[model samples]
Target: MNKGNEMAGPEKEILDGIATRSVYALGANAASTRYCFRVLRRFLGEGDVLELGPAEGLMTGLLQSTGRRITCVEGAEAFCLSLSARFPEVEVVQALFEEYRPDRQFGTIVMGHVLEHVEDPVAILKLAKGWLAPGGKLFAAVPNARSLHRQAGVIMGVLEAENALNDMDRRHGHRRVFDPESFRQAFLGAGLSIDFFGGYFLKPVSSGQIEANWSDAMLDAFMVLGERYPDIAGEIYVLASRPAP
Candidate 1:
């Protein structure tokens, strides 16, 4: 539920409306999230962790496993309430990223699958940069515009272009799809240095297509395959830090 600060009235309602729906818990999506955590785990920072748009706490649950004092900031009240009840140890704050004013910096900040949903990805990244403790890292992942599935969609005439949003994108309230170049530029634009940039989940088709036809073994295999071909991976990630003074 990442949104611009200018969002108001109907726009706010629209985002909240999308939040009430259970999308991430689905079969393929759930598997993707697990794989996302596997990639995130390698670069997770020590001490406190700040997670943005945790949704149903799938990633929140994973972050808690590290025992790093988790705090989640989600804009949707329904999600905030659900997260609080589900993870009593977690501190869930219900507020938009633009309005959230944390009193202290954090060791790690995660924005898994969040940038594409926001109205201003660069602005959000800049905001996150300001909240990082010295040497802390910001980890963000977004759907790749050049993913095999997306490229296939364009070739199959299901999408207008590689960067075009599909049915799932609209349903999930995604504003844009990011390719490798644009994804890297967002971090650079935020004045952060790239510590690591790679991707995971080498999805060859749509989530629906995979869920209907693929086996768990096949799914697991592709999850790791993306590391070798990150440019076209289903999801890409960047680990960034503040430049040296």
Candidate 2:
């Protein structure tokens, strides 16, 4: 079903521009997306899945492998077109998360790397929570502000603050970075009960540095090592569900 809506004017252009950027295609980001999917697999419930902001369909490809009915809500027309062409099996809806209203609830709602870009994360989470069927789980992940690399940036005087957006963050259209505490508060603010909170990919350096120097084995090892130290991991995630009635 090609139920796609068009977004007009500057906002649409902005989104389409971001969609064409090569940031998500980076070696580190691609690897991280795979690792994030591995973490998400354990928490996925049975039935349909809803994925928000599946830019370039990196995680979308992984989600499709589960043989579950998958629907993706993406704002960028470019991404929507690419995703639809790349995975014709997936139903891609081109609407801002603020405007999307699905007819059915989902067993799993994923907001992978979405919070940092949104103008209102708690509001988005609240919407996702509302769209969850009973026993459904909402899985969300975002870059960690306190990750070793960010912290190192601060100490190196490259970043004015750990939470401050860097050049890469701006390039990626990230509005804010969340440390563990702030990240948890977003879920709680949305009235979601966290089922699992953890992190992955213990990056000791920037993505550029990693791509230039790190081997595949080292990348894989660090991806596993992030679990032991969630506080300083490159990315953090939560598996959450609505509070019982």
Candidate 3:
């Protein structure tokens, strides 16, 4: 998000533009934008919602009609501006999530594709745990390192392992890749429990490959396989909640 720097120059503009373009790309990201909502549907509760790293607000915009007040903490200034302009009702805080202190806790916190980019995932997660009201849920999602495409890469010897960071991931600002165990460890160590955990999108190839070669109907079918084999899906999701008190 914002290349870990202040928003300025052509680089930030280019990066900010990616989200807008990606909305039209109908690739993995657009797919994620759609699928993540389904993941949220299983756990989203009534009351205020806090969203972290809502770059350009694809999901944020979607959440608006729920009639729940949405507050967003974004790392990119351009993103904050876009989100504000696109959805004026949302409270957009233009700061890194770790730095922004919440005035109050939320009934639901949705963090999507953010942990993989942050420096200290557990610290952020620990922060997430602190920000939840009792019985509230945290809807979190991340890319799966051991996705079927990566599995194929491993068998082809192009990838050393499932956890191997490919050029595309590095370019997209992914600091680490996660299989289910590693992903679960981060949340568990942060002192949270996942009430439900599963995968969403079964990506048999890279996003670009899928967009280029597969039909929309076929892609929809692949999503079903994720429910059966989550460990190898393109993205993993969990519905986490605070311990009853």
Which regions of candidate 1 are displaced past 4 Å?
Answer: 1-8
Candidate 1 C-alpha lDDT tens digits along 1-245: 32224536665676688787759878888998899999899988777999998988899999999988988988777788789899999988777788888878999999998999998999999999999999899999999999999999889988999999888889888999999999999999999999999988999988988999999999999989988899999999999999999
Model 2 reaches what TM-score against the true structure?
0.97
lDDT of 2 by residue, 1-245 (tens): 34545555666666777887747856999999999999999888898999999998999999999999999998887788889999999999998887888999999999888999888999999999999999999999999999999999999999999999999888888899999999999999999999989999999999999999999999999999999999999999999999999
TM-score of each: 0.95, 0.97, 0.89
Specify the highest-TM-score model's number. Answer: 2
CA-lDDT, candidates in order: 0.89, 0.91, 0.80
Question: 174, model 1: CA deviation in Å?
Answer: 0.3
In the order shown, the candidates' Cα RMSDs to the true structure are: 2.6, 1.3, 3.7
After TM-score superposition, what is the CA distance of residue 155 in candidate 2 from its true location, in Å? 0.7
Task: Pick out the ten consecutive residues of candidate 1 with the lowest summed lDDT.
Answer: 1-10
Weakest lDDT window of 10 consecutive positions for candidate 3: 1-10
Ranking by TM-score: 2, 1, 3
| TM-score of structure candidate 1 | 0.95
> Candidate 3 residues 104-161, lDDT tens each?
9999999988888777889999999999987889988998988999999999999999
